[model samples]
Target chain A: MSDALPPGATLGILGGGQLGRMLAMAAARLGLKTCVFEPAGDCPASHVANHHFRAAFDDAEALTRFADACDVVTFEFENIPTAALDAIERRVPIRPGREALRISQDRLTEKNWLRDLGLAVAPFAPVDDAESLRAALDRIGAPAILKTRRFGYDGKGQARIATPDDAGAALAAMAGAPAILEGHVSFAREISVIGARGLDGAVACFDPGENLHEGGILRTTTLPAALPHARATDAVLIAGRILTALDYVGVLGVELFVTDTGLVVNEIAPRVHNSGHWTQDGATIDQFEQHVRAVAGWPLGDGRRHSDMVMENLIGDDIARLPEIARDPAAAIHLYGKAEARPGRKMGHVNRRTGPAA
Target chain B: MSDALPPGATLGILGGGQLGRMLAMAAARLGLKTCVFEPAGDCPASHVANHHFRAAFDDAEALTRFADACDVVTFEFENIPTAALDAIERRVPIRPGREALRISQDRLTEKNWLRDLGLAVAPFAPVDDAESLRAALDRIGAPAILKTRRFGYDGKGQARIATPDDAGAALAAMAGAPAILEGHVSFAREISVIGARGLDGAVACFDPGENLHEGGILRTTTLPAALPHARATDAVLIAGRILTALDYVGVLGVELFVTDTGLVVNEIAPRVHNSGHWTQDGATIDQFEQHVRAVAGWPLGDGRRHSDMVMENLIGDDIARLPEIARDPAAAIHLYGKAEARPGRKMGHVNRRTGPAA
Candidate 1:
């Protein structure tokens, strides 16, 4: 295990999206410098990081140079080319480890891994071909979502099936890639637990946020999710189990479905998650700082939300309201600095505080 | 007057000290880009700004290049050699204006300007020679401070005259420079108001913070200062008067002395003030962001102090206690990312919240 990093240490971050931009800024707050490695020129994170390695993620020489400069390495996203990680991990430590990345990268593997740990998750089965998909559909039943095993995000690369007759069309929707057939849980509400694991074995979780989705994209997340105290404690404990089981060493976002039976895990992200953005305003030390502290081997921060907050994502044209939003005293606007406001793009988010909860 | 700046606009900051570093970070948080212009390499702000202009402040070519890139120009320090500001001001607007800078850059000018505005300030006199110094010392009385009219800060370039015998020595300390001898105001406590004025001429002010100095350097600033409601209102009004008189369009830090009679103006800083650092944790929007918004021609932010906080400067070796401080869940650390822990240097600051006040 690596020792804790000093203040002046350089943190090498892969990817230069809004997540990386926020991460770099958080690292700066703690006296750590960040160097961002991104293929795109003038990316969001490049404007804030201490340094920018403008090169592809798969470039071996660039990865070597990056690792040489960084005391420890971390990534904002999980889709980093495994070979690039292999090249850098040998030279420097990568928090959340390769095992966590490998498992979280595939939907079928992640579901099976969670089931093996005896955690409750949605019923899912692997579907590699049309025959396998047909067989899995028979076993998992109709009214399922067929999602690509890898690189699927934001309702992309996924098709919903209503009946057995629609199965072939759903399989074709996968474009012949590996897929997973997941049985939908009749959830009453959706909530997410943002948790962090430190360099030591200790784990800490922030208050869960009740999530609302529109068109398969996150619209809002309300903090202190109106869950029963016992259930809220269970959500935190479940997130801890997942982190400890994966030997995770960073902030993880676990999206859960609040069903009639109990809480069921829908997915887990290995880095700072969108649902945890409320912590930026409501918590003492936010999820971005938590991720930085964990990756730097520092102890986890206080996870309690000091105030009640509702986070709303500013997708695409929602940015037009920024001028008026800027005048709102209750809202804290966090824009990603993206140039183009394409439809469905994650432009930014606003955290509106609802006062401190007793 | 300039229109409001959009999120992608670049802000040109002239100075790369801790103030600029914090401002750059704040601009990044708002999705605004910043380029730092400083003569020194690897300065604190350089690490966080999107672009670094490593040239002297008076470098006309560099200033021109910088102005061409920026939508507006603002500065962290007031001593930005008038010629450089002239070069940049022709290309884009500089918030708080050159008039504010000219008055605040010199002690005598600032005091006179404040006194002319029907404000309460300590009795003072400008001294150009030893004879004038003796005359002024006699008028202002002994047990006073003889300070350089220009470039005096952190109690440097200042000498104490305890008695008539000490007059000559104190005058000699200026080393052939203009000086100001001001009579001391025996005050109850020191307080400062951080106020912001946007392009639209609306003023917003944070609650006053009680300041404590050790060895002529700011040690800590406590928010929601122990003051009567009327005195606080007077302080805010006085600050607004100064802002309106100067036609200011950015955050201003006004130091005041609470005397038996009323509030006496100590001095005013034209940019974000160290005493206002508590707003970063205690308020919805901080002084840094307020300054950014004002300079960017945006509306002022909410200046309410949401929580009680005490900001302690991590000067020099004080940073050694970071590990212990980090363990204190209430303290949010903001390090400037300086490589060395030089004596008396402000390496970082810690904001310890005392909880939300009623």
Candidate 2:
């Protein structure tokens, strides 16, 4: 590991979404400054920070200035160009590193990494063209998902080939992008383990949360996941193994499927996840703070939730219910500084404190 | 008393100190925009806000622009000029309005207001010059403090006159400014009631915190003060009375002396006080958020502390001890983004959480 970053040092963030906004707040609490880089004019992180470079990822001058200003850099989203990271890494250290990025950016590489780490993932095959699509379908069989190998998120750029006739529509819909076909895993519930790994190989995991999705967007996350104790232990161990192998230095979100037989890895997020929002009210240190502490080389705080928590995402029209939500004694609301409530956009979230037993 | 600032509107803050920084963070959580106006470069509030105006308070053009950009204006420091508020008030309402400033800016006026409000304050008389100082001493007696009527803070611009021979020296020390001579209160403890008052006549108060001062600077504040339950209740009621009588629209901090007879009003801070820093981690809703909610015309939150707390200020060299403090499970540290650490300058603070019973 490189030299530790002292307090009052600057942290460079690659994306300026709500995740970066929360991350900046956490960094400030630890006496660290944040310089957020984003392309949007009124990104959420800009409101809470003064040092912002509003330039595209390819702007070398801006990138150089950002690298020069920060002691270490981290990204809020996984879609950051590897070339931009390469240019900055020459000047400053980037935590969670580029190795994790390369594997997580593409679905096929991520799946392979999971399997290589001795983790159970869905059966999958790569598809580059019509011939490969047909061959992969023959191997994975029907009722498989055809998804772009790169840049697919929140259920976008994916289609289901349920029958022989649907293959043409699925292939045409995905266009010319390199893709992957995966047989669906029979699961009873969706759960995610949000945990952090330090440079010294210390792993701290938060309680797993049960998640619900609506129209391909996360709607709510409730703590005390439905998984059995042994299954939860296995889920955390799998996540820890992946982080350790990648030599990750920040929080990693592991999405899992709780099947009747066993737990299977669904996907991996190399940064703080939306499902971890409950930690802000329920735990001693939230996921953002934990990520900051891990990256800053501070000892990770206990991620135990003191009380049960229910976190609900305020998406588009759901923001209209803020007045009612504000009146609830058990609820704590957080709204991002987005101007318009567009469909599928994350506008805000409300976390409600529940009974400990629940 | 003025047009209600709705949830989506912006709140303007005059000073960019830690109190304003906390206020801006609080406003962000409520879906309200915060615009901080301060002359200094890289002011504390500027780092955690959506908009910041780097202009002097008396700059008419800049003040007009700032006033037009905000729905309501509040100040973090009481020494702001009346003319500045008059300009902003012509455009938007100023919360904890001009009356508070009028009282707080002049020691004589503040003393008279406390007496007028049917509250107990130190016996005092005005002194414009050496002749007047002698006259004031005859009425108030010796062994009292001679303080300037305006622009004094943290024991500065004041002198303790122990004898008739020291009256002339104290008067000369004040540089012929308007002043007040007051008999000091002998109290068992020093405590402050930090609370917020909504425009709709709602009031929320946190438990009183006993304060300790060193070298004329506040060093520590311990919550769940040793005062009797009846006295704590009286303190909250008195703070509510002052907030209502002044038509206060935001958080008001009332510092009191817990004497053997009863609680006496020492002074009123029209904005958040340093002694309330513990609320950042201990209280469910901090004083900063409470002020933002009151100014935004939103309902007040439960300002109860989840645990007992002791907040210690990190003055100058004290900041170097943060690494040891961070290792403690109960410590919540906050650092202001200040470049220099001059003697007696506040650099940051640490809040240590203890169980409520402590």
Candidate 3:
């Protein structure tokens, strides 16, 4: 509803993690100033953003000051506290809007939304208590995943059920929070599409990335994914449909399962996704910039891949290879500027160009 | 020299113009922090650098404080005050070393240094006064350029001796300052090689970017410069030789005139050059990062061009084309956060990729 932001306008970023760090860097490249809101003193985004508000997300005064200073507000994480949004929404517009966040915050709502749109999704049943867990297991079957309906990320807040007998433990793991039991779709491969929609209703989606995971954490995302041509096309169309349906004006990462039946929707992230990191080196316009553009009311850029790439995440102690990564001329290294590289921590990434640009 | 700077090390930047703005961004990509020293509040680099020292270049107290905080210092311009360097050199190492700056600070010294090294240069004579200017003009021949020995850039402090009769006014233009009169070389094309040398003596040179100038300011620099393959090789080797001769530990810009016989050295800038701007999109590692790496004692990246590119400068009101430039996916637009766009001011640049990356 607002006018397009000028080049020198300030972009207010919520959650100053690696995503926000890259976003701040991208905004700065476009001559836009960024103010990051994060409680941590050493948040990665704080290192690069023009200004930093070191306060709790729900700190009303801090939120007021940050929203007052920024020309536009956009957040990277979906789990942003409703109270925080409530405090800031009165001051500035939030891109992707509150509706997208409300649906994505709960697993059941995301699945139902996809199903309502006539998209294929893994069979899922909501579980609120023990009585419902048993009833849902009967409907969804064993060897399914029971995930908390809200507040989950990077393999957190979820448990797998091997059999019907294991349902109780999975239910107990939810700790009384609402849960969704998703039956395994027998996926051939995991793929993700990073889609963006601009303020003027223009939508763009990158080619699906063949994703690989290690211990439930993303390890690598390779472009030119090994998928049937039809499936790849289907992925982009589905992603665009979701973007348009939500009236989203920022990047959304849609996870998919290449199943025997077809491509099944896994979930959606209302921000730049890890699987899209290859865009930094392999594409003319990267996803971070795309998100920034969409949030600033600028037209969406080409999400087309320019080069073949393998984007590898440098989690935890993987940062020890910084020296080695630096030696390779083709290795486009991006470190989050985090102070410490604790085990299982995401420190940096390397996007290696494996082939020629398109 | 100290060991290679780690990823999180702080790099002190001497200037805060667009060049420094780019250097700070590149340093951030490498997970390094930058502190910029500039008196202006709205300097382009101040918008992105991690820390800023708002003080005059000649302020010894500020210089000492800056050096004390940084791991090492590197400048983005050649005209850094000697007194500032004198104050900081004892506290922190300055990359490219003082010798390169000392030689480049004076046109006569730079030319003589190149000639003494067996490098081809325009035939020149020193002029200290009107009589000497007339004598130099006669010796160097007409249709030559008369340039002040010190503090000259962008066609400033220079005049043309169009004919033998035009010497008096040209001498007066120098205002009795020491000057150099050099006979011009008829060239096929003007080109520049961006070369780098590390503290450990490794050298790398980017492919020459053939340049065009209007009103003495660079208008465009096209890669794959249309030079004979052998001449291009010679350009790189000559750049490397110059880097080694100066014991430089940072990026250097070497301008050359391609004549019928061979290449003739015009001058050298002891920092990142505008001519190398194409590397931002055409190479995996750009010149700014190369400069930062060299100054930080790290290995030089492959300076080989990946994609064919034409880097066009957006000077003055040319920035009004943002809407059009933003429509081109292949245009990597880099805008300096400068508020005013005075005529001849470099407001931004656009690197248009023309071919696939090699």
Give the best candidate by DockQ: 1
Residue B65 lDDT (model 2)? 98
Clashes per candidate (backbone, < 3 Å): 0, 1, 0
lDDT at A131 for candidate 3? 86
For candidate 1, the per-residue lDDT at A163 reads: 93
TM-score per model for chain B alone? 0.98, 0.96, 0.97
Better model by lDDT: candidate 1 vs candidate 2: 1
- Model 3 agreement with the true structure over A219-305: per-residue lDDT tens digits: 999988998889999999999999999988899999999988899999999999999999988777899999998999876787878
DockQ of each candidate relative to the true complex: 0.66, 0.43, 0.61
For model 1, fnat equals 0.72
The residue-by-residue lDDT of candidate 2 on A158-222, one tens digit each, is 99888867888898878889999998888999999998987677898998999999877899999
Candidate that beats the other on DockQ, 1 or 3, i.e. the better one:
1
Question: What are the Cα lDDT values of the candidates?
Answer: 0.91, 0.85, 0.90
lDDT of 1 by residue, B1-358 (tens): 2387888899999999989999998898788999899999989899889899999877889999999989888998887798898899899888879999999999999999999999999989999898898889878898898899999888889998889798889888999899999988999999999999988889999999999999889999998889999999999999999999999999999999999999999999999999999988888889999999898888788698788899999999998988888777778889998989999999999998888856
lDDT of 2: 0.85
User: Which whole-number lDDT from 0 to 100 does residue B284 have in model 3?
Assistant: 85
The sequence of per-residue lDDT tens digits that candidate 2 reaches over residues B1-358 is 1344544578899989878888888888776789999999787888887788999988999999999999888989999977888899999988877988888888899889989999999889999987788888888888898999999887889989998789988988899888889887899999999988887888889889999999878999998888889999999999988988888878888999999999888888889899988887666677887788787777777776666789999999887776676666556778887767888888898887665433
Q: Which ten contiguous residues of candidate 1 chain B have the minimum total lDDT?
A: B1-10
Tens-digit lDDT string for candidate 1 (A1-358): 2467989999999999999999998999999999999999889999889999999877899999999999999998988899999999999999879998999899988999989988899889998888888888888887899999999877898999999899989999989899999997899899999999998977999999999998889999998888999889989999999999988899999999998899999998999999999998898899999999999988778797789999999999999988888889878889898999999999999999889856
